[model samples]
Target: MHIFLHQFADNAAFNLRRLLCAALLACSVMTGCARYVDKPIDAHASSLLAPLDPQQISADTKAHPSTLLPVLDIDPTGPWNDMQIGLIAVLTNPGLKAARAQGGIAEAQVFAAGLLPDLQIGISADHPDSVGVVNAYGISAGFDIAALLLHSATRAKAKAAAAEVQKNIAWQEWTVANQARLLARRLPFLQQQQALATDAENTAQNLLGLTTQNVDAGNAKLDDLALRRVALLDTTERAHTLARDIETTRLSLNQTLGATPEQRLPFAAKSIARDFSTLDANSLFETARSERLDLRALRDGYQSQQAETRHAILAQYPMPVLTLNRARDTTPIYSKGASVALTLPLWNRNRGAIAVAEATREQLRIEYESRLHETRAEIATQLTELQRIATQSELLRQQLQQMQPEIQALNNAVQRGDVALVTYETARAAHLDKQIAALALAQAAAEGEVTLELTVGVLLWQ
Candidate 1:
């Protein structure tokens, strides 16, 4: 009984040890799983709170502040003033370069067209007595005159078309460059307005701070502070909007200048000076009619079409063919002779070609008329816009002059604390609004003036 009891006690001890080991293994597994889950969560939280790198912060701080462009030193006595940037662009543009190359091609075509038909030569050998012997060797020369005549007219039309294409290309390049210069000039003024908006925002913030201080000192109500804060926020947002617009304009101007957006450019604030020297609109229109390259190109096209129609009608009468042939033969019978050949106009008269050419000439005439009418209408519309904007600009200038003293008085009153905060704020806002409006009016007037100058071929920029 004692042995059995001892064995039972040993068995009980072994079971207790096994239970303790199992419990320890389970605890270890659960602790490892908990640690694995917590690791990712902790890492994510740390990443969220990570501070910005000092190097990046310093680099950003060192970036240059945006600045207004400086004025360019344009030569007053140079031919550059007489010619607009448009003319320069036309001279330097790649499209015009390609068009000019077409002139060389047209010249080559003339050579091809005027070439006389190639002479034909033939040689024959015969064997008479089992040994090869030169029985007959002949050379013949012949040409068709009709082919040359047709080619000459075609070459002339090609040359005329090439010339018109070159002129049209030049006109297009000039228009694009003119528009670019105008846009570049306007960009600086837009930037100036953006800066003004920034100043207004800063002023609003300063006023808000002052109001907050007054409220803290029991000199102003909480509502007054809140109102000033709201105003400041509104002004700040306006400044931001204006700044964004200015950036967009700047990028567009840069693109026009053929520069990357990151590249810096200097474009001065430019205003169109009123030309005390004014020419009659009718006179200007006449000058444009004579000087405009696109119009001249169209006229050239019409003349070419007329020439083509005449050539095609002439083609209906089969061109008389004149051929000269010379042949030499030796061996079986020796013969040498020169003969002239001619073809009668019998079956094929170019009636279809004549009809097509006449129809094309009519189409060209219609196109020319349409282009002229459109150009004249454009000129009239641009002139009217220029006049209207000029009148509006003068009125705005007068209004600004009249408001100057009043704005100054209001500014002084606010600085002296004689005006209520809300009254001062409102007056300041009005002044700023008027200034922005005046600037916009001025810009529109300048644009219109430039457009008129372009339409009339009056050079505006040096």
Candidate 2:
């Protein structure tokens, strides 16, 4: 009877061990089947520099696609303003897209950190050769309590990192948008300068022709005709250079919009904007400390480092594990109990990680301070530039206003033969030069205003 009982117990233990092994094997197989597989590489030229279609780019945005889609249908014969150009850049700039994707990565990490740690299941079996004894089998399951305790801070760090990414993305978008705005804002002024250069070239050519005729007829000095020809050449070169600059500026605008350089981008003909001379620099600096995205990102980074430091400190303590276990033996004995697990801190105490985390926090703190200092300086410099530009633009406007009628009178006198041809031509060229200078100053003032707004992390125009 004793031998039969022992056999029955051995059979029961063996069957239980087999059942547990089979279950574990099936779980492993299912998990292995669900593992990620890499896709085959298709080698080809990347699309980094590909011409972006406004409609397609709009549709690809994660949100607010409708805001940009309609911009494609807007009259291409535009009086398109800074806002329109900024919108296009915000929706299509590749730099901003890359920065935004980083935020997504951080978000995924945050989700991963919030998830519960996987449960660990373990099984073991032993067999004895004695006839009265039988196989022994044990099964246990547990989770790391240290991981559970560290979850809050780890998730906090990930969340902070995600916030930092978002701020960086916002700052990048602002950079792209500001570039497009400045280009669009100044393009019309460049166009006007080109047109004026053309006019000056045309006038010089006509004067050179007239002077050549007079010299051929022995009615004017050859030296005077030579001087006119030289002036014509100079003006022609200036016109060509200005034409090239205008074309380049347009292409730069296209690049900012993430479109082809050959694409014609229409912008408003007027280039002037409201004067920002009265904006208090100190006030803007204060606003920027709170509102600048880059600065905010630094603050977020510091907070994340703080959480990491906390997590590293916690890691210095030993990890505690609690497991529930079941065991059976061929002697007809069965038991169930809870087990505690812990690691001794005699060897590794996470001191290196803690020190690294502390050092990183300090680095972020200094970076934030350095950025704030630089931001203040930028605000001051841009404000001073705005004032100087306002004054310079005003003076140029006055000069232009005073010279226009004088140029007209000189033209009339030259046509009526009341003034010397050389004198009239010189005055006309000087007047055109003044007009170009005034337009350039106006553009400078407009751009200065935009830059000041950008520095302050505020949209003055909007």
Highest-scoring model, lDDT: 2
lDDT of all predictions, in order shown? 0.60, 0.78
Worst 10 residues of 2 by lDDT: 66-75
Off by over 4 Å in 1: 1-134, 147-155, 202-257, 275-280, 320-331, 335-348, 458-462
Clashes of 2: 0
lDDT of 1 by residue, 1-462 (tens): 223322332342334344346545755775554344445547665543443233332233234211111122233232222122233333333454566576677667656656667544333322233333332333344556566677766667766766676667656655655666567556666777777787778777777877877788898899988887898888788778877877887676555434456744444546755642353566667777777778888887877777688677767765654433322222334455665554455665667878888898889889878876776787777766667667776787888788788878877887899876656666666667677777776777666666766675545334
TM-score between candidate 2 and the true structure? 0.84
Return the TM-score for candidate 1, rounded to 2 decimals.
0.67
Reference-based lDDT, residue 226, model 2:
85
What's the lDDT for candidate 2? 0.78
Least well predicted 10-residue stretch by lDDT in candidate 1:
64-73
Candidate 2 ranges beyond 4 A from true positions: 1-21, 25-79, 126-133, 206-234, 329-338
Clashes of each: 0, 0
Report lDDT (Cα) of residue 449, candidate 2: 73
